[model samples]
Target: MKLYEMRDRQSFGFSAENPSGSKGGGTRGGDCEKLRPCIDIQPGETVTLCETQGPGMITHMWFTGYIGHSFILRAYWDGLEEPSVEAPVSAFFGCAYDENFADRDGNYPVLNSAMVLVAPGRGYNCYWEMPFHKSCKITMENRGAQAQTLFYMISGWHGAIPENSGYFHAAYRQEHPVQKGRSYTVIDGIKGKGCFVGLSLAAGMNGHNTCWVEGEAKMYLDGDRYPTMNYTGTEDYFGGAYAFGNDVYQHRYQTFSGLYTGLYAILGDTSDTYNHQKRFLLYRWHVKDPVYFDSDFRMVLDNLGWTGPRYDDYTTVAYWYLESPAPTPVKLPEDGEMVMK
Candidate 1:
């Protein structure tokens, strides 16, 4: 965030050609053309992209592939046993539902934000400053049944971190049908000091034909009985209102992406297949106004105003920063549990 302040650091990069990220990475083959630009990730395989001792920060990351939904991304900081960053590849880059309604030109959806960006035709990019004190390691796992080709780059600077710098973390959760009585917990059990940076949310109606986005967002900090911070409506939390720019039954679901808020993906809408089920992708980044907690933190979304056999499915990814690079207990959904019909 210190744009004007220059700091001493060593620049490094990791890619298929430079898997180790050494000084002369791309020259292993010496003057060879198209030398190891992509990697084939087989089923049930994990690839270690970066593993370096660091008092450093990851400035940027880029990945171009069709393995978002099938591939899992995990990052460990400060030599932790568990990863601080854990989510599906596409979901972490602001597209929770992998398949999006194509644009007018029949291309992929786009998400252009301050921290994450998804270019046309499946290019995923991130600009979050991930810092670690002792060490950092990032890995990608292909859990799908088929093989996937991936071209990626991880770049950063090795330097001294500020004492106040917090470590980056991400966790993914999903609720199909949202459960009649239970609300959707975006993230919970974070028992430490940190600030909630933002979240990516995807919703799909399971059966009902009525508008299903009347839920509201709530934030519970420091062991509160009720939420100290709450929003008027769920769409309002993501800077959208009146059912995400269109009535669910009548019009095409519009898409948008901004610096801090976005409704970027809409799948199988009236404009697409005209099904009763309406799926959406949305996000809101609290870059300017993060929800800080000193002791503990949790947040949830209320599934208000509905009583029927039909309900909505919700997929959420919570991004935040912790005080240091320590592992917290996190249970992620298994591959079988997240299969979209």
Candidate 2:
């Protein structure tokens, strides 16, 4: 099963099985521009994006629209009721903050990687190789106030997936106003064998003139009560030093869109709460160095700031690959809790 061996083509999208990009099955272009059909999902309605029995791999997924935390995207593997991948549409693709954050100059901050890329034109793309043996299902829900217009495509090929390939999993969690002297759990309730791959975080401070970079990331493996692997601070885990240095420039060593890690966004303000309500978005991928766990895995981040302890709002989506499906509750935050202040 070579990757580029030219297999059969299979695409599930909004199109009506049109071979060419033309409309009305004619050569001319008069009223044949209905090639792309978009859907409007009202609140509380779930729309099935893709469902197929496969011995194939999903090669590419591309979606772009006004997606936010209120729009939930879920993916199910095999015939499981629980979704293996569930998160807000924006956060799932590594865009944690505002979607429309561009000025007249068209300068906007975004995060991009080999697997996930959020382009400047609001095009969200995913190139993860999701291989399933029995079946695969993908759905989207509109949990927000206004209706959502979605235009997307899921393209893949029919072939036998590799034997040792693990199932991909992603979970979104958050702890509002992190407790003092306590740790915020990024991922937990795992009951399978998997390797931690990547994580994206959105941190917001709630205190006046408070600093949120004095935290550390910890990973507990295989029933260990304490973390076997721990880092010094939050910024350090995201490939930064000295509170990101306020350089306002992307550096190689500090943090940028490289191969393994990146610091995507840092939204700070001087007026609100004396800059204590500022927010930061950071991400790290364990592509080269994955945290392998056999029995279970848990990840946490310290709430310690610069001076003693602190409290803040922390939200994250943890990405991993598991040998067996570690079914966890797909409980999302309430409508009020999901909204970012």
Candidate 3:
């Protein structure tokens, strides 16, 4: 019932030795403003980010770095070998393509929402409440060639978790040149009761086609033979209309960034290239309204385009909560398949 924070000021450990001592973290005797100054974030190694035995709920998380697809973040709940949450740190934070969405040029735009935010300083923040009954473990893996340093903070309350509380989960998936007559899986392998909370989708056209916004998203819940929930089109799912103002308007780009939904980023050249092979970063949060599921859940996105079926690259991050641990291990892609490029 009480709140606790684990940060570098406390030697990056959560110990409730004295309730009032945390305020002194950045003081003279404490570690001070010198937060985790990393010499190296080693490659091909899994570093334990946070581990705590006993029940607790992870309330907030923040991370900033030169994130790429090679950096993977994972969290295991209640001693489960398979991580309940797994995604590339970049994609998980709602940006993809192994690129920083923050810069002085204002080309790559940052997203701010109720559940997740990618800020101006390349900072990523999440307020998903993750409850664990037995233990919680978080880890980061650097799959890149060189060492990368970053700043991060994961703080939550440790004590008795609610009996009805569900465990938080997010998954990352990507498909290049989506196959013909098939839908892209956003998140699957879900079991037990849960509520779908949010989705982040990034896509890029494979060719110089202008009609790549006709795709629709679908949600399948609880053993449904077909999708129980369907969207009109991909742009509609992210609260946009009319090809995201791509076809009709002569402008270089049109975007919408709001509290619940964001058509945040559009990559295009202002010259003769037009919006060809344009890249986009979009997100939607189901905070005010959650999709409740009893037994299972699966989500998919259609690849149909206006000019006929089209193939495009798709990457997504799905956020949800489940009553029980996942039935099977959440296997991450192999090292060779993890690169974003």
Candidate whose TM-score is highest: 1
Q: For model 1, how does the per-residue alpha-carbon lDDT over 36-67 read when each residue is reduced to its tens digit? A: 89899999999999888878989999998664
lDDT against the true structure, per candidate, is: 0.81, 0.74, 0.74
Q: What is the TM-score of each candidate against the true structure?
A: 0.91, 0.86, 0.85
Which lDDT tens digits does candidate 2 get at residues 212-287?
6778999999999888989999878888786676433542213366556777665655344444466666778888
Q: Give the Å error, residue 240, model 2.
A: 1.6
lDDT of 2: 0.74
Off by over 4 Å in 1: 1-6, 28-32, 100-106, 247-253, 271-276, 305-310
Candidate 3 local lDDT, 54-159, one digit each (tens): 5777778777765677778888999999888888898888887655343223555778787788777677888777888998888888887778875667777666
For model 2, give the 10-residue run with minimal summed lDDT. Answer: 14-23
- The C-alpha RMSD in Å for every predicted model, in order, reads 2.7, 4.2, 4.7
What lDDT score is found at residue 6 in candidate 3? Answer: 42
Model 2 spans > 4 angstroms off: 1-32, 99-106, 208-210, 247-255, 270-276
